[model samples]
Target: KLVVNPEKIKSLKDVKGKKIATPQLGNTQDVAFLNWISEQGWKVDAESGKGDVSVVRTDNKITPDAYKSGSIDGAWVPEPTASKLVSEGAKVLLDEADLWPDKKFVITNVIVRQDFLKEHPEAVEAVLRASVRTNRWIEDNPEKAKAAANAQLKTDTGKALPSDVLDPAWQSIQVTDDPLAATLDTEADHAVEAGLLEKPDLTGIYDLTPLNKVLKAEGEPEVDDAGLGVE
Candidate 1:
């Protein structure tokens, strides 16, 4: 999502010439923002993050502070970070999801080392089964899931998310079993077009058989690997 101080910007056009932060240089969010900027007929150096718009590579942990300090006008950030900025008086200017088809895109991925996967196929399938069930559980009981997530967060970070942040943040997420492989391929294309990445083969990058097996057992529809699955 793209969040800005309401006092400073009112519309997408106002984003021109503003210092916008992305989570990291050449990351998924950075590539998407760059692609959007290009679509606006604007120019920005992909590597240095300078031009008509300043793409500041700020860490999510410090982005709200950067905005509060007036160092950045807005941020194209992921969940909790976006919600946290909103709590500090930032208004959502645009949702990145709106730009994609059906407002769906991949935000996270689970990767397993090929060697480990080959040796521990059963373990891999077990993990996928657990993940599928957990996603469904989260969807079925959102409030309980939120509380449980906050509890885990507290254990890790020494504090739980405040309702102001947690509520909106939780609302923005979509827990899905699909890997959204096609969108990931599109993201790579966007990065290449923005000069942040080179075109490269992505064949055999996915192996969704184990996931599909779990989904089938759970009485769910199977997912495709966007033709990038291992042969």
Candidate 2:
């Protein structure tokens, strides 16, 4: 999501010549933001993060502080940071989800070393089963899941998101067993367009059989790997 200080910036075009921040120069959100800028006919040196709009590569830990202090006008970030900025009075200018088909995209994915998978297929299946069950539980009981996730976040980070931030951030995310492979391919293309990556040969990049097996056992439809699945 792109969260902006509404009092300072009202629209996408208004962002030109303003200061904006991304977590890091070559990270996923940074690449996406750079690609969007190029699409707008705005010039930004992908490597230097300079040109029309100053792209400040701020660390996520201090991004909210930067925004609060008016050091940056807006940010392209993922949740809970996006929600944290909202708590600080930032308004979401873009959802990113809205830009994709069906409003679904990959934010996180699970990958195991090829050797580990080959030697421990059963272990992989067990993990997939747990993943499927956990996703279903979250879907069936969203409020409780949110609380549980907040508890874990607090344990890990020494702070829990306040309800105002947690509620919307949790709502924006989707938990599912599917890897949403097509969107992963699209994201790679976005990075390429932003000059962050060369055209990647993604053949055999997925081994979804284990995930599909678990899904079928749960009476769910299988997910496609966008023709990049192991044959």
Candidate 3:
């Protein structure tokens, strides 16, 4: 579907002056869309320095409802919720996975307090260790992955998620605790390439030593990069 969803969304020009629903202004998706609107040469506000696309501020869960009631044109929603909305009657005008060909998207990520990492270094190691195994498990077991995901999200949604939503999300993701630096080396590259940042000077962003030490102790097999997302 990455190949199917073109980066140049057709008829977004039709949306000039129309409300573009998003989770939050200046959050990643908002930034991406604003950049795109600028690229399209539409009128942007001088004072706010934002795009011509009217930003419809809403929570992620409420966005589909906003769309249904004709309050917003479309939303920057995460899967399986995004695709679920389409199934329930809202149209999927732009699926980002389909929009950016040969590129992948990052969905959920784990964030820990800096103090937590500093104080409980061993705990961090355990988490990464469990994550390594979990990552491997997800790669090896798609059915279980879907079941776990559906259980986590679908019960909240009150319906079975179409596999189309879960399949792509699962395939495009990995579960791991690779040192943030190693992960961000690739992430920074993608982020910069996407014009999200000028450059990511990863000075205080991550530390890899604790995780490396854990891997050493575990005699962990070097995981292949093929299935796991983004190196």
What's the TM-score of each model vs. the native? 0.98, 0.97, 0.67
Best by TM-score: 1
Global local distance difference test of model 2: 0.91
Report residue 34 deviation for candidate 1 (angstroms): 0.8
Best model number under lDDT: 1
Candidate 2: residue pairs that collide: none
Clashes of each: 0, 0, 1
The digit string of per-residue lDDT tens for model 2 on 78-163 reads: 99899999999999999888888999888788899999999999999999899999998999999999999999999999998899
lDDT of each: 0.94, 0.91, 0.56
Error of 2 at 114 (Å): 0.5
90-177: candidate 1 lDDT, tens digit per residue: 9999999999999998878888999988999999999999999999999999999999999999999999999999999999999999
In model 1, what lDDT does residue 222 have? 97
Whole-model lDDT, candidate 1? Answer: 0.94
Model 3 lDDT on a 0 to 1 scale: 0.56
> Which regions of candidate 1 deviate over 4 angstroms?
none
Ranking by lDDT: 1, 2, 3
Q: State residue 6's C-alpha deviation in candidate 3, in Å.
A: 14
